[model samples]
Target: MADETRATALRVGASEIRADAQAKAEGREAYAADCYPQGLLWAGAVRPGARHGLAHARIRSIDTRMATAMPGVVKVLTARDVPGTNRQGIVHKDMPVLADQKLRYAGDPVALVIAESPEALRAALCRVEVELEPLPAVCDPVAALATNAPRLHEERADNLLGAAEIRRGDGAEALASCDVVVAGEYSTPVQAHGFIETENGVACYAPDGTLTLTLSTQAPFRDRLEIAHALGLPFERIRVIAPCLGGGFGGKDGATVQCLLALAALNSGGRPVKMHWDREENLLAGYRRHACRIEYRLGARHDGTLQALHCRLVYDTGAYAHLGAEVMALGMEHAGGALSHPQCSDRRSVRLHQ
Candidate 1:
């Protein structure tokens, strides 16, 4: 039996070892961040500084003269430079590639600076000056739902991104009649993916206008569509090559560096353009797990059998709607908890501006 088990373990298809594990352990596995093509340019985003304080604001103007005049600085592009709809998302076609009229969040990129070197790119970005008109901001998800609250998106009449309710039986009536009832409120903070790789990608535009990108992204196929839609390029002309990622706990499952790298490549005069987000930028601009507040009311019989459950889930989905609706729907689906109950009432809402 022992000999047979060893033989099975040695079989090609039945091997217990991961094929890439050895390479990765020996530092021989090449990730997207390791790629450095010849004649590569560096691109960086200029976001609202800490001095701005407020996340919500109007962009009065972006003065790129200083950065444009700096040595090795290639070009400073803003939202106007983006060709297509300038929007990218999975299901919701929101989130601007660059902030145009409004700076939706403190980390919102207002300008893209391209340079011959990473040092030049950072220096140039620092030289770019922006004038903003501060807008009334909402920090609380519940407060953002108030009618008197300032609107984050003019299109969205309210800060509510999505809402839904699930009902199985007469939960309200059942709760009142139960022999024992308990209530509680639970809250969770916004969580970062904290992937070791961070967000980085390299893109090069061919003479024929074909754009190719090699990135550490979890969604390479979807990235092609996102790049095409955001930059007005033909979907067929875009190619995304996803390499072995160092880490990506759902953080790279969305846009991340896809659209930005493509846009930088387009303006790099056909040279390969590389954009890498450092740890700080990753925390500020990365897609994060939603912060949630949940209220629960549980009713049980004298025998300790659960009779009814009522739950209200509210999630702060941040400035942009990145799978906000789907996130809320998932929470609603699981509001009943692990134990089964005959009656359950679940209400969920996804809010923005957090």
Candidate 2:
């Protein structure tokens, strides 16, 4: 009987094959990174030579002479070459497209080297020597919030980005009336979105002053706005085309290679420029889920009915505020579990433990 059922299911499935299955099997699907044109320029970012510091890297000497003199070498452009605003970000314009002042993180881009061949681009990036004056780094969030800690952002007092609180039904008063109370602490680890294809894209500037981008992005519509605002280009001048992503899972929800690739394309002189992050580069530089520390307290009646509930959630946003506060807010909202008792005086009280 089981074999008959399986056979019937197979027969039904055969007529309803997925549309993407045939194209994938035949290798006909076109991914964004696969859209390479003739005479394409290769672009790569020069990562920090060291770790954990205020990266005061000066372009005192970029010995690109060897790279330029080499076969199939184009131009090695630094922050000085960026025609518009060299900064890029989603909500907060804190990140620089090319690091001009000091390298904030180890993965900050110091130079954008364009070459006729991928091999030449790699060689040129290696030859670029960036002299950096390292400053003390605040690796820990708690230490970063300390009064005397080195400020990551000079405009802010400490490293505290944001804080929020929610209250309902006099939780403290109701907790006193409860017969039983429970308290505990919990912590969650940082999660990585291991997208299969990694982050990759291709960008090209047309002769008509239009910048076109084909990228692995989830928010292609929103990416246009961010690119225009960051690069100081007209919104109509930028066009973004999103293809079937290898995987996004929220990590690619914001600006990744869109802005940098756009900048590289603009400097490519109408030639298409490609940027593909290998496995290691993606893991090291890609954004991850925010790590969180939570404290929970619950008050209950004698019948195991929930009375008052309170929780404090703290999240390590890490460098930028990439939906960290929203994630914490969602976690706080679910702190009461699934059940709610009317006999209980207090229903919910959740606060962001900044």
Candidate 3:
């Protein structure tokens, strides 16, 4: 019935042309991902290689001599170049803008290469050498919580990032009095956004020491804060302009090319710098929907009236804590629609527990 109402309402005035349809269809729309300032120096990353593998490892040494000597390669930057916090995240500032001490994921960037052209940037990135030391890694969540499992962050004692609960009425007591009950275990696999435009951005550091950035991002204002905080620059000095995007779909909701590209521009001697991830890079580094495991028990009266609901949900945010806690909270809001299930008392919702 609710679905019918929603569909009916949409049909009345739906099918209206989109605001960006004409510009997009005419190929006249300018996307932040496609922004290119004049005299743009391309920037690329040199990722840690095979010694320690992608699952986990520790950084031993980074050798950028060869890449730095490349004809067009301007500067080879590492953790040494990053100032201020050197960490970036929407909520938790745990993810390193440049991987310094640990390589949490296979996609962790070890170094940034700035060059005069895309060809030079790619060549320089390939020439950069890195050495890694293998460490005991806990790839599985169940194993990660083990007493002896390797700690991803030495500061953190366990792999359990967080937990949550929702509640209403005497949930357990209500379930005990129910006439019908069903319980099940459910799981969902991770799904990628596969956005068409990929991740890309352009940034410029002006002679006046202020910075301006135009990029394909969902939150431009937030990007300004992230860049300012991560790079140790004044927040007011940075201007983030999001022209438009071919597509973002939450993948661009957080920092993607903002901080790193800004770092490149900082050292580009007033020249604009650009960073655009290719298809392969995006798939490995881009954000995706969290895979989840849920245990739910539903109780109801013999008359088909829902009496109570109890559910536990787990969200695997992967290498970084992107919107893990927030996403889980949203799913718990409905508890698979049990909140709308009719109740015997005036109370119409199930409760949540930690």
Q: Write the per-residue lDDT of candidate 1 for residues 271-332, one digit (tens) a residue.
A: 99999999999988999998998888898889998888888888998888888888888888
Per-prediction RMSD in angstroms?
Answer: 2.6, 5.0, 5.9
Poorest 10 consecutive residues of model 1 by lDDT? 344-353
> How good is model 2 by TM-score?
0.85
Model 1 residue 188 CA deviation (Å) reads 0.2
RMSD of 3: 5.9
Per-model TM values vs. the true structure: 0.95, 0.85, 0.89
**The best candidate in terms of TM-score:** 1
For lDDT, candidate 1 versus 2, the one ahead is: 1
Q: Pick the candidate with the highest lDDT.
A: 1
lDDT of 3 by residue, 162-195 (tens): 7656566677788889999898988787788888
* Preferred candidate (lDDT higher): 2 or 3: 3
By TM-score, the better pick of 1 and 2 is 1
Q: Arrange candidates by TM-score, highest first: which order?
A: 1, 3, 2
Record all residue pairs in model 2 with backbone atoms less than 3 Å apart, i.e. clashing: 55-103
Cand. 1 Cα-lDDT: 0.87
CA lDDT, every model vs. true structure: 0.87, 0.73, 0.80
True-structure RMSD for candidate 2: 5.0
